[model samples]
Target: MIVLLLGILVLAIGGCVCVVWADRGGPRWVRAVAAVTLAAGELLRIARRNRRRSIKRSSGGDE
Candidate 1:
């Protein structure tokens, strides 16, 4: 389990690096990895936002 978590952490760091490099005109593969990373980040952000909205509605918070 620890190894898996470490691997994920490393990958996330690498993805972030690729994103920066791609922005500065890195190779095609780097750009591809950056695109995937950005998409995944956006999806996760949207999912978390939706989850928060649902939780608020359930608890009777103002819409």
Candidate 2:
């Protein structure tokens, strides 16, 4: 489990580096990785918002 988490952390860090490099005109693959990373981040953000809303609703909280 720890190994899996470490792997994920490394991938996330690599993706962030790719994003910065792509902004400065890195290679095609780096740009591609950056795009995927951005999309994944967006999806996670949306999912988190939805989960929060659902939890709030379940607890009878008004948003």
Q: Indicate which candidate wins on lDDT.
A: 2
TM-score of 1: 0.93
Residue-by-residue lDDT tens digits, candidate 2, 1-63: 999999999999999999999999999999999999999999999999999999999999876
Worst 10 residues of 1 by lDDT: 54-63
In candidate 2, which residue ranges exceed 4 Å CA deviation? none
Backbone clashes in candidate 1 total: 0
Candidate 2 deviates by what RMSD?
A: 1.1
lDDT of each: 0.98, 0.99
Q: Which residue pairs in model 2 clash with each other?
A: none
Error of 1 at 38 (Å): 0.3
Residues 1-63, model 1: lDDT tens digits: 999999999999999999999999999999999999999999999999999999999999886
